[model samples]
Structure formats: structure tokens, C-alpha cells
Target: MTSAAIIPSTDLDRPELRRPMTDPFGRTIDYLRVSITDRCDFRCVYCMAEDMTFLPRADLLSLEELDRLCSAFIAKGVRKLRLTGGEPLVRRNMMSLVRSLSRHLKSGALDELTLTTNGSQLARFAAELADCGVRRINVSLDTLDPAEFRRITRWGELDRVLAGIDAALAAGLAIKINTVALKGTNEDEIPSLMRWAHGLGMGLTLIEVMPLGEIGEGRIDQYVPLSLIRARLAANYTLTDLPDSTGGPARYVRIEETGGRLGFITPLTHNFCESCNRVRITCTGTIHTCLGHEDASDLRRPLRASADDALLSAAIDRAIGTKPKGHDFIIDRRHNRPSVSRHMSVTGG
Candidate 1:
């Protein structure tokens, strides 16, 4: 298959003509997180339940349809795209799509294109992903202990994840480790994980366990604030704040004596919504305007049935136009619990 994207490079991204997708609070929506599939191999306790039901293959946006939607978003001023899922690699032959987007990145149609995975299958696909113009990969690894890993994910083996990390390094892919810092669980392992990630020359991002989706009664107990984790890490080393070069919400810091960088994605305690720049699209083509709220627009109708880029783009713009400034995700959990909670997997967590 040709590496060139079917979309043209010039008119494909007329940023000036497109009205900047500014939310009601004035945060420009430029990052697009696309869920390729809701199917995953491992069921992480924090992210998904043991027995999960995935969407039917027919219900998902076709790869070509996704490409078209991405084209529309790009024209509308989406600068970055991250491929996420229940496990993006679980989708069959995803490299085709990667190659397709890689061409866009190579041609400057996007500022960056990245992928987030559980790393179970990275050992097999790392080299190809690197060769296809994917410069960076983020692997979700909550614990370094084998038993704890098994307990957290309920199925994945730590050895496989380690092998995937090795393969990622072998392929020369810039890597990041995303660990959910659960309150009583893995916060103590922060130093060890930081050391190991720095040893591998990879930056580690500690994400506070958010109240998103259902935690099955473990929500309160699992919520670990970044303050606690930072305090724990501070005992061992000093951390200096660094710039968030990638436009992500993760507040970065340079780990004082090593080549390591650390970041905290505190969705709860630290409200980064003032600079929030992301919008999520589910595998079935629903545009989630904010991860904290349920405001969404079903783009599949216009995207697939009508094949009208104008309609699809307008639908997305409408969703962003009224985007909530901040999610009451934490507040709602404190008082009246909403009857409906969005599953992190379905929303591409």
C-alpha cells in the first residue's frame, strides 16, 4: 500500500478558514483521541471489568470511514491524534491504518500522531510501528511486581509486558510508561517505576485514578492524588517542573539527577481544563466533547450514511461549540451519583 494519504496536503488543512474549535471556556480543541476498537485482551481492574462486552464489528467505524473522519477533523484544525482503545493492537491489521496516518504525519498534515497500548502485543509490532513513522509509544503498566500485575490486570503477565518494553527499546521507539497511581496500591512503587523508566530512557507519567466509568466500589479507595505520589517521590529525589511540549494535560517535571522526566495527569485534584485541548471519538463514531461530561454527538450518521464531510465537520464543531469548561466528574461522585457512567474502554480511556 502506498504511504501517501489520499487527502491532499495543502487544502486538506486550511487552518485559517476553519474557525478555531474554542470551547465555551476558550480552550481550543486541537487534540483528537480516536478509539479504534473496544476489544482488549487484558481486563484491568481500574479500566475495565472482568467480563466485558465489545461492540459488534458492524457497529464500528470502518478504517476507511475513520480515515475520512480524521481527514475532516484535520481540516477543522485537529493538530494531534492519539490511537487508543480497549487495546488498539487487538484490532486486526491496525498497521494499515497506522501507515495511512504515518503518511499524514510525514507530510505535515498533523503535528504528531501517537498510540497508547497495554504493551501485551508491542513485542510483536514495535519494529513495524517504528518503521511506519510512529516515533513514540506509551505503554500502560501499573505495577512492576508480577503478582500485583496479575491482580491489577487480572490476566496479563508481567514478563510479557517487560518483553514488550524491551522490543520497544530495540526498535528505537521513544517510549513513555503510563501508570495509574492508585491510592493504596501502586503509589509506593513510584520510586522504583521512576528508576526503571529512567534506566530505560523512557519518561514515566503517573496518572491519578479518576472516577471515570465504574470502579465496582473501589472508586474512593483507588483515587490517589498526585500530591501523595509526588511526596513519595520527593523523599528520594528533587523534581523540577518542565514544559508540556506535547500539549497534553500531563504536567511534566525533570527528575533531578537522571535523564528521566516525570508527569502527573491529575484529572481530579488539578483542573487542567483551562488548557484542555482534547476531544474523544468512540469506535462507533460518537464524539465525546469532554471526558468529564457525557455531552456527545453521534457522527456516524453523517460520516457513514451520508458521506458528507461538511455535515460531519459541522456536527463535530457543534459538539465543541458548547463544550463544558470543566467536568463535574469529581463533584458528581461526592453528591448525587449520575445514573449513567461511561466505561473507560468504550470512551477509549
Candidate 2:
């Protein structure tokens, strides 16, 4: 949380460390999630409380600053970039950033460009996004039951999200539906949700509810493990394992003879930290090497002070150097998960 700048005296002439940050399992972390804003239009029960506060716009990073930081990161071996937010589309001129990032794709500097959204504004921006070279999207759709959707999100317009999903698909964007699995809330609706997504040619990723800060307290009692979800799916339909696609954290499986795939992200019950090659940059410009750790490196100060390439590179190196071998949440065997001061909206889910 400190704002002081730490400048390194090293020069940029040193040999570039292009080596992939691989784990014991040989899984490399090449993905980076950058949160553009902490503000969201919906108030999901598991992400925020009814009275949560928002960060001031003045504190958030400007588009130019984000582009510079992104360029620095790309120069440092980060190949894939994911734009996230309380809702990334909520940020002004988001398409402009997309367009700027698209320029990198032409040079093969960025391999993949994606975004995660709550889908309230997705319909309005899908075409512009596709035109800007965004190829993939991940929409968080917890339930199809309109009443349940409204109840869970507090103020989400379900129809709007559905329309957005349709728009994105119409625009030729590869889409995925991200659903957080809770024991009593929408667990029973998994099959229905999967069928819906599959019907639309979109993959469905079922995420195990995680204890991410105080908001997690409301979900602790409702956590649903992967084993239970798999069992439930098995009872309803036959599943086939997709061959040669087991590298990522999500276990990809598909219903027999179905077009859509099912993914499971079991962070709470099954720790995937050993294969975590991804890091997160919050909207406030803090770099989080691990999702479950308290450690973070501030990048805003140096970035704002017109630091030279050497200093910027050194800062990135220091942040990655401090990246823990793995998060200690599971190793510590703690039952009560700590409450994260920054909400997921701000942290980019």
C-alpha cells in the first residue's frame, strides 16, 4: 500500500531474462490479467457486500500509463494479456485501448488478447471489440433463472447480459461462460447452464467458490468442490475427456457427442498454484504475483515518475523475483480465509 518509488541503478544492457516462469510440473505462466477499474454496475453477493465502496477515478491508472506498463510487461515475456475489471467495458474509451493493443498483435508482440465482463454492457461493445481485434471473451453468468440472477447480483439486468452474449457471438468472438459454483445457490442449475452455453457454442467453466477476503465469508458455507460437481454432471450425462488439453488449471471435459466443453477451476479444494504462470495487476497498479498471498509490488509511482527502461525492467524483475514458489493458503492449512481489502471487481476477478 506504500506509494514510495523504488528505483534500481541497474542498466538495461543486461541479458534479457526471457526464460518462462515454469513450475515443478513444467507449466509456464505466460498469462497476465490487468484490472482497468474497480467499479462495477452489479453487486454480486459473493464479490461485494451491499454497502461496498469504490475507488476514486483520480487514483486509477490512465490509458496511456496502462499502455506503457503493458508494453513493459510484453517486453518481459508476458505473451498473453487479459483485460479485466469490476467490468472492463465500464472504463471509458475501452475500445481505444483495445485498438491500441491490437497494434501489438500485428507485430506478433501479443499472442492473445481477451477480456472478462459481467455482460451488462457487452452487447453494446461486442462489435467494436471484434473490430479492434479482440478474439475471445469470458462472461460471468451465474444463473439462468431471472429471479435468481436478480437476487444474487442485487441489480443485474439478466436480459441485458443475455443480449450481450448474443451480440458477442454474432460478432465472431470465441466466448466462454464463467459461473461460480455455490452449494445451495446455483449448483443445481449447472446442467441447465451447461446445456444453455453448449446450445450457443460457448464453453462453460465452473469455478469452485473461493474465500477471497471478507466477501468470501458469505460463501464459505456454500463452497462446492469439483468432485461433487463432476458427480452431478455424470449422473445427468456422459462426459468425455478432451485429449491433449490438460495443461491449464481447468480440467476440460465435454458431454459425449456435444459441441461445448465443460471446465472446472477448483482453487479452494485442489490448489493449482504449482502450475500458476499468471500474475495480476490491479486497477491501482499493484502487481500480485500470487492470488492468495499478501505480497504485492507497487508499480504506479515509478511508472508515473517517467522512470527509464532500465528502472522499469528492474522493477518488473524484482516483482517476478519475489513471486513465491506457491501460495501458502493451502500449506498453512488455515480454515478461515482472510478477507481481501480490495474486492474482485477492483482486482479483476
Pairs in steric clash, model 2: 29-277, 213-339, 213-340, 214-339
Worst 10 residues of 2 by lDDT: 1-10
In model 1, how large is the Cα lDDT of residue 17? 36
Off by over 4 Å in 2: 1-28, 243-247, 328-341
Reference-based lDDT, residue 159, model 1: 97
CA lDDT of every candidate = 0.80, 0.77
* Residue runs of model 1 more than 4 Å from their true location after superposition: 1-19, 331-340
lDDT of 1 by residue, 226-247 (tens): 9877887777788898866565
TM-score of 2: 0.89
Residue 205, model 2: Cα distance from true site in angstroms = 0.4
Q: Pick the candidate with the highest lDDT.
A: 1
Which candidate leads the pack in TM-score? 1
